[model samples]
Structures are given as C-alpha cells and as structure tokens.
Target: MTHTFRPRIAASIAAVAVLGLLAGCTGGTAEETTEQTVTFWTPQATPERLAAQEDIAAAFTEETGIEVEVVAMAGADQDQALVTGAASGDVPDVILHASTQTGAWTSQGLLDTEAAAAVVDTLGQETFNEHAIEAVTLDDQISAVPSDGWTHVIAYRTDLLEQAGVEVPTSVTELAEVATTIKSELGITGLAFGTQAGTASATEGIQSIFQAAGCDLVVDGEVTIDSAECTEAAELFLTLRNSSVAGDFDVTSARAAYMNGDAAMLLFSTHILDELAGLDEATPATCAECVDSPTFLADNTQFVTVLDEENPAQYGAILSYGIPTGANVEGAQQYIEYVMSNGYVDTLGVATEGRIPLRNGMADNPTEFIDAWGALGIGPAHERTSVDLYGEEFVGGMAEGINAVYLWGMGTDDATLAGLVASQGVLAGQIEQLYNGAAAEDVTSAMKAAVEEVQASL
Candidate 1:
C-alpha cells in the first residue's frame, strides 16, 4: 500500500494523542491543480493506520496518476511540523494528526474545516459514531471524519483471576473490591497502573474507568470535573492507582510485566493485543496467561466516549489527506475523496492488520482490525464502575480528574490532591516541552490555572 499524502514515520514524541479528536471546519478547499505530486504527512504509521494509509494512496495513484510522497514524522513532533507547514505554506496535501489537540488546532485555523462539509454528505451522518464527530464538531460544522480509533480496557490475566478465585468487576465498586481482594488474599497486587495515573496509557486506555463511572467529560456543553460527581471519580481513581499491582505505566515496563506473567490486570488499550502478537512467542504467553477486559457498562447511562478513543467510545481521528489551504487544494481534496470512498477503505480491510473499514458494511464481517479493537462485547467485558462525569465536564476532567482519583487514593489531602491532578494536564504536554529542560513547577502552575479555567467555565 502506498500513501498519497507524504510518507510517514512515527517520530519521537512525549505523547501524541492517537485518538479521541474533535474536528472543526474552515473555508472550503480549492480544486486540484492541473498536474502534480501531492505531499502527505503522518506519524510513523502503525500497522492499521499505515495499512489504511497505503491502500488509499495506491488507489489514488492507480486511478488518478498522482504520485504521493509520504513522510514519516514523529508523533511528538508532527504537530510542530504541521503548525510550521501551515504557517509557512508548506503543509502536506493530507495530514493525520492526533485528536487531542484537534480542538485547539481548529480554533487556531491550523486546519481547514469547510472541506469536511463538502464530503460529509458522502461520508454519511451515520458513517462515523456521534461523539467522534462531536469532538471535532465546532459551531455546527464538522472538521474531520471520525476514522478508526481504539479504547481502554482492564486487561487481566484470566487464568490468574480464576486461580485467585476473584472475578473482574463490572462496576467501579466491584473493580476496587477485586483489586483489594487480589492483594489481601493472594499477596498479589491486582491492577497495574502506569508510573503516574492517567498518563498516555491511562488517558487513552484506562481512562474508561472514569467513563464507566457514569461520568462523561462533557455534558450539555459544560465542563464538570471539579463538581462533586468528579470528586467521587477522583477518589475512585486514587484508590485504583494506590492499589495497582505495579505503580508504573512505562510501556516497556508494562510489557515486560505482561510477558513475565507478573502482573494480572493492566489498564491499557486494545491495540496492545496486536503489539503483543509482534513480540516473541515466549513473550506473548504471559498475555495469554491473561486476557483483555473492560469495566462493563451497566444498565444505566448512555456511553459518551472521548473522540480519538482507543473502544466503546470510538473516539474518532482522521487518517486525513489534505492539501495546503492555498496550495494543492484540488489535489488534496481528490486524494482525500478517493481515500474516503468505499473502494479504497475496503481494500484496507485485508491489508496486514486488516482495517475495521469505518465505512458502512464495507468490511461487512469483522476484519482483523475489527476483530482486534471492536467494542462488540464491551458491556460484558468487565464489571461496571460508578462514574460521576457527564457531557462537557469530562473535557478538562479527563487529564486532571482521573489523576485526582489516583492521588486521593494514594493518601493526598484535598489541596495536595488538587495540585497533583493539575500536574497531569501540564505533564501531558511533556512531549512538546521536550526541547526545553522541563520546568515542572512552572508547568504545574500553568496546569493549575487551566484547571481553574475549566472550573470557572463549568
């Protein structure tokens, strides 16, 4: 598969939110120029996203005779390059950026939204999930199509759970009880949390715990993390964090534990399954000793997951192809149009890690992508947990609120806990701040201010 957009490479990044993006609309794009090559930019293409990228690019070349130069940029630095490109008039024909900064990016005119409207009709209102669109939706206009995404789940060692005679909980309370029991009875720490709670692993993956708590980030266009509802969630988060079998979220460390069969439960994304597959057979046996599970949704509450979500929420992202606002508009649009079509996306279904084929019935039966990441049985995956978030509130609450839950559980008082939660937000920007020596205090204070902003807006 060849990418029409510039070539892609996963560049170094502290964290480039892969899913859960909110898109925006801008002035309509221009028509493709007479003859030319289109440039596309993307992070190091993962198997799934890469497969889809190449499928569309190859199709475009075959049909339109346009050659695309794909660029492999680091996830962390893609934004800097993208922003630079947009500013200098050197942006790619299409870009696949993380959804986390989508809102801010759109607000800043970094991306064009009007083009999204041109294709929304063909994409179908139902083509992508609702929240996926909502995240990128601004002022009644959609910026990007909610493409494929992932979700967080409580991956557990099923064999271990059975041996310990402890069943995974469907509810938050049960989840806690199980964690506590695993520790008390077998002297085994039950859950494995990242170094800090709500980091990338938790934010993109385990953050679902908060979602299952019946607390959504946004509710009726209001931010609600500081409210009593999120307070409870905060407490629960702290409790889970303090009780994890391990207290580190470093991907390398977690994988080692998973392979060693030392950790039973992990807050991680569905994609890990594929990553595990790529590992040595001996390494994956530990995961087989375990299984992926989620906080089963209860009978109550309609799920409103984050965009760019890692499952149940299906947070959408754009594996988009774009041309510079004033450059390659036509070519970019044509490239994107071709990729979005059923024919090309359809080809993605069988390319390596077969795509889920976001287009309707295209990948009719679950493809490798769907089989791996689909939220088909989310309700029955793990026990449900109590959540206190809803709607607009979850936005700011996600980064901080989740961390507060972890800190409070770890024994911090209200004031101290609040500061800790605030840190997670700024800490999230660690990747971007990489060039400069980290100023933890300054960053934390800024995060504190941001949290206050969210609270005031709420």
Candidate 2:
C-alpha cells in the first residue's frame, strides 16, 4: 500500500462548491442538491489494510449514498497531522486511532464527544464492550466509538513446559520461578521480552506486568507510581528481564527469539498470532522442528492471557473511530454506525489476528460478531481462521479477556496526562534502572517524580 500524507483538499473543494450553490440560489423554487461525503483519516495505511478500508467505504457509500474519502495517515505522523489539521479547521470528519489518544484529543477540543455519544446511543451502547466504551469515555461523555482491540499474552511452548513438568505461571512470583526453572532445566532462554529504554514495546512489556500487579500509575488524577505495589511490581519485572535472553531485546528480537526456538516463552501482543503459525514469509517459523513442519511451534504453543492471580488483568490496545469537532456530524454518524454493524466484520478482517471485535454485535445476537471474528481468516500466505488454528475454546477465552483489558489511565480524568507520561517512556527508563541494579524503591520514586514532571508540564 502506498503511504501518502495529503491535506484536506476535499474539504476545501466542498466549501467552494457550497459557496457556489449559495450564490447561485435566488428567491425561487430551486432544489439545491449536493453529495454528502465524510472525510475519514485512518492510521492503518498498509496497502492491504488500506484496500480493506476502501472496500468497506465503497459498500457504505453504495448502501447509504454517502461518499467516504478515506485518507491514509502514517501512525507515527498522525498526531502532528491531527494537531495541524485541528488548528487550521481542516480536519477529517472522522478519525480511526489508538484509544490512548482519544482522551488527549478530546481534552484539546479536537474531538466531538457529544457526536460520539450520539453514535453510541443510536447504535445501542449495550452492543459494545463495556470496557472499550469506558476507555474512550471522559466525564461521562463518549469521546470515540470503540472499533477493535487486542491483548498482550505470554505465548509459551507447551511442549517444553510439559516436558519440564511445570505448569503455566499465573502470577508475577510464579512467573519468575517458572522462568528460572525452565532455563535451568532446559538450558535455554526462559522468556523473551523487550528491555530497550524509550521504546513502546519495552514500555508495554513492563506496563502489562506492572498493571497486573495491581499498581496504577495515576489514580484520582495523582501520580501513584511510588506505591508499595509499584515497588514490588518493578522488582518482579527486573527478575523477568534477568530470566530473558541477555541482550538489548526489543519487539523484533524478542519475537525472533521465540520464532527461532531460542526462547521458551515470549511476552508479546496478539499480532504475533499469524507469525506463530508460520504464515508470514518474512518471518517464517525457524524452530528446529519447523524445518520439517513449519507449524510445529504453533501446534505446541499456548497463550496465557492473565498473569496476576490476586489482581487479574490483561493489557490491551484499543482502536476507535472518533468524530472531530468540525466534522459532518450526520454523515460521520451514519458511516460509523454502518461500520459497526453491516461492515463490522470486514473492518476487523483487515487484520483478524490483531482486530478483536469491541462491539460484540446487535443486541439480538450478542456473540454474532465475536463468533465471526474467530472464524475470520488470518495470515498472508495460507490463510486460516484463528478458531481453526487455536480452537474455539481458546478464542472464546481471548474474547472474554478483552472485555476488561487494562491501560494505565484509561477512563480517568488524568488519562491525557497518563498518556503523555507513557509516551515519554518514563516507566521504561525506570525499568532500565532496575535492570542496572537500582533498588526497586529508588526506581519507583524516580518514576513517580518523572510522571509528576510530565503532569506539571501539561
């Protein structure tokens, strides 16, 4: 797919057309007609993803007679583009973005919370995942329509664990013990995860463990990273890091280690689902047994969704559709409703492995979309449904876990502040300190101070 960053030229053209219509109309029985088009900005800019979105847009236009001008925005450049567009009153009518940005954008007056709430009401709020809806809500106003999401998981080699006679870990303490035991027994890396400072992968890796430990970075609009829970979480995360492959591990290296059979367990997102099945040619399975059967690792792998037994939670990334303040409200609402209903499955099918359905289905059939999601084909080479690969039982468990996925400050007054602090990699930097032998108490104190500085800057 081609990546293009274009200005809102279509909005300008529409404005000119509207002016022409107004000038030409006189005091007569004249029927002034114009096409309704919703400008949509999406960060899913890959060629394949863009094509899938275009297909959905085309269907929406055919059914509703409302044109959708889909704009591809690179994920890295979307924030800057949104800021500049909002300043010039040239923003798209609708935007598809990560849930992390919804609160911040709404706080900046770039999003229309009332319009979003209207869409939710029109579509029946009960149809959507309650947690997803809550994630994009601020001050009782829905800032965006939840589209899709995925959770982080511990993908482990079931075969190795079975041989070692060790059950899967369910808490931080058990996880560390399992990792240490696996390494000592098997003479291989026990866990593979990112540790690189200032990287999103590293931040997410630690954040998942941190949150699972019942520690909240921000509570009641105050920085709480210095709590006792945070200190214990930090210490446990360092132990996990110590058990991981010794090196500068990032997302790529960690996945590579697992795919190449160098690690027994991998802390990664659900996006690795297809790769585990040896479907992506670029990163095919390279495990020893994979030479004979590329899917050997997949067949021997199992996913652990929740790690904390006492405080069970799963870290996730949610993508949503947001209507901007100056958007064509009517057209945007129609489009969002259609995408969440008739076109919902196709939208999620863009990348089934990562796009878990947030809106379950119509009120009549709550599991309609959830069931379809499990059956959606995945992988670039030989497509196969997740249900076909992992079975229905596992897929259902994942869907259930997604309903209560956790993020640092989602659904809170300080969500924007928390997002800013997370983006700055404060937690990851503090994690690096832990890796370097800093006391957990000291690291937690530094994390609290850094988060406070970020909050003050806002």
Candidate 3:
C-alpha cells in the first residue's frame, strides 16, 4: 500500500515533468528506436479483461505489423512508476490511465496533446460521449484519447434498509441519520467507505463526501479548504464515522463488508453491481446470510447516482490513453485508433459490467456500442444478467451519471490537482482519527491545516 508517487508532497510538478522529458527515455532518440515495436502500459484490469487487452493488441499487430508490448500496472503503482519513469526519461510510448491524471501529466508536458487530438479527430469527435471528451480536455487541448468511464454511487441493501425502517437517503444529513439508524437497529456496520490513509480510495472517500456538502477543494483557482462548507463537510464525515462506519475501512475492506452483508451500505463504483449480482463463474458471497438468501441483484439493492441535496452530484472517473511526447507517435496513434475502431467492441466486451463506453458509436451507427453494452449478458448467481438487472431506467441513470461526476479541483489546472492529491491523505487521516475517537472540532482544524499545507506545497 506504500505509494511511490505522492502528488500532495511533490516538490515541483512542472520541474519533474520537464526533467522527465529531458532525461526519462530508456536509451535512444525516436529515430533510433525500433519502428516495428511500441511499448504500452495499461492500468490494471480484471484478468479476463487484461487478457482481452493483450488479444486486442495482438490482433492490432497481426493487421499492421507494429508489435505492441502490453504491460499492466495497478492504479497507484502506475501513478508512481509513470512519474518515476518520466523522471528517468524511460516512459512507455503509450499509457492507459485514469482521466484524473490527464490534466496533471499533460501539465507536466509528459503527454502529446497534439497527437491525441489528431487521433480523436480522425475517429470523429462527435462519435464519443461528450463527457468523455470533456474529461480529458484541458485548456482547450485534448490531453488523451478517452477510453472507458466509471460511475460512483451509494449502493445499499434495500431489504436491510427496509427492515431498519429508514427511507433512502438523499442528502449528507439524511445519509448520516440512515447510517446510524441501520447500525443501531440491525447491529451491523451501517456504512462502509475507504478511510485508509495515503491511498486513492481514501482520496475518493473524502472528495465524495465533501462534494455532497457543497464544497470544492479549489474554487475559481483559489484554495478553499478552510471555507465554512468544507469544514461542515469534514464535521459531517467525522460524525458519520464515529457513529456508524467501521474504524478500519478501506476500499477492499469496505467492498468486502458489503459483499459479505456485514455492512448495510457502501459507497462504491458502479462495477460493484457485477460483484453484488455475482459473476458468471459461480463465485459466492462470503456473507453467511447469502447462503440461502436472495441475490442482491434480485431487487435487494438500490443505486443512487446523485443525492437529493443542495449541491447534488456523484463522483466518477474516466479511463484514457495518451502518447508521451518522446515516444513513437505514429505507432501510438495507430494503436489508439485501432482500439477505438476495429478493436472497440471486443475490448469493451470483456468488462461491460463496469466500462461504460466513452466512444458511444462508430461511423455507421451512433448507438451501436452503447446498445451492445446495455445488452451485455454475463453475470450469473442464479440466472445470467445483461446489466439490465434494474431495468432500462438504471442503465439510463448510469449514462446520465457519467456526466454528473464532479470532484474537488475538477476543471482546474494541475497546480490545484497537486494540492488536492497531496491533501487526500490529510483528509483521510483526519477522518480515521474521528473514527478512533478524536473530537470533530480537532479533526476539522487538522484538515484545515493539512489543506493549507498542500496548497502551500503547490
């Protein structure tokens, strides 16, 4: 869980990026490198999906004779390695990464925006989901080729909530009440969320709650961590954790808790629906209640995209690929184009449960991929599913949900992102302290100080 890249504490992001450009390449200039081969680093996908990616790359090679080296890197690890590789001037030709990293890395001048834009244009910009394009665009430049997207939601056990006699929560205050009530009535953890210090999950946990409280870590390019709204958000999180959340919550633990029926509610990505429904391979839930219980996919869960509150929004992140400035631009562009075209269906087919296609269509058909994704049949605990578990309404909600994604420092420049990333640990740690019995006032004060520290560092 140790991170190699600490954006919050990065000394000089611009300097690091420039240094990477000047010194990071493995050995020779672009002319000296082999034209037949291009290196690609992919963010970690499921084993099946990873294998599918390799297959797609291989097929691309078969057609074009340009060999692609597919390397899988986990999320945080990729972040660390990319920064390190960039610093050493040894980055891969193309990297598949999260949308959040687009602004940061592009600002560092690590990404070739001109090359990315060309590919997007070649593929036709109108073919993509507008949100996908917006996610990767910064300062009027397309930083990366948008790939897939993930929608965040507050997923809850409908049966359990009903038993606890609580209504579905639509606001931060209402959610807190529901969590407390569920815990007290059911004698189970009411909420599960990642609070692990110094991890991406922790950052996500903090930002999700903070947004619900109507606070942006940065407002109009100014640090607003000390604003009244942010403080209230922190206070609200402290109150919830102290009353109903597990003290040791992290992404893995939180998901496990929900899957095992040990938690009544979980804040998670849309992918959890696949897990809750059970995969086709006959994986069973570890929850004792699941032995003879109804499947969670059987009208036992509720998915919430946006809360009904003053500042309503849900958290989401996009996946994308970009060519580094010093790499094989032609090969990189070709590979990206292939993924968006010839390989599009097969590539997204592997994880249709979670990957909402950013490129919603092809030249001939506007809704081809989107429709295919909607009807993707795979999961099976009892009967197989087609991601239509909750009906077309749920699917439409998710499609709309992608556009509703908002996070702290979103749409801002890289400097603000640096502060946001750096302060993630601070916010996470403070929340954990509250869970461990720290006073709310103290936690809020600490968060304010930590936020200031991150902003100062930037």
RMSD (Cα, Å) of candidate 1? 12.2
> 1-458, model 2: which lDDT tens digit per residue?
11111211213111111101111111112121126767787888776677677778877876766667777776556677778776666667788999878887888888989989999998899999988998999988899999999988889999888876799998877887888888888877788887787788788887888888888898998788999998998888877777765576898999999999988999888888889998889888988899999889889898887776446668888999998877777778878999898888878888888889999888899888888888777775327777777877877777766876879888888788777877788788767778778899999999899888888887
lDDT of 1 by residue, 1-458 (tens): 11112222323122223321112122232233324566666664555444545555665666777666555565567667667656656666566554444544565676667765566556565654344455456566666544444344455665667777986566666667776777666666666655443355544323345445544443443433445544454455556655656654565666566545566666554334433332223334343323441111111112222322222332213233333354455566666667656343333332222123333322343232222222221111111111221223322323221111211111111222233333354333332231143343343344335555544542
lDDT, candidate 3, 1-458, per-residue tens = 11111111112111121213222233344444334576777765555556667777777776777667777666666667777776666767788887767777888888889989999999999998776787788888888998777767888888899999999988887888898998889988888886676676777777788777786666665656657777777777765664444575778888888888888888888777667765544435667765676465435777777774345566777788888867777778888999888787666655665677888788789877666566665442213444456666666666666656655555457435543554456676556666667665576677767766776766
- Angstrom error of the Cα, residue 372, model 3: value is 2.2
Q: Give the least accurate 10-residue stretch of model 2, judged by summed lDDT.
A: 17-26
Give the top-scoring candidate (TM-score). 2
How many clashes would you count in candidate 1?
Answer: 87
> What is the descending TM-score order?
2, 3, 1
Looking at model 1, residue 125 earns an lDDT score of 58
**What overall lDDT goes with each candidate model?**
0.44, 0.79, 0.69
Q: Which is superior by lDDT, 2 or 3? A: 2
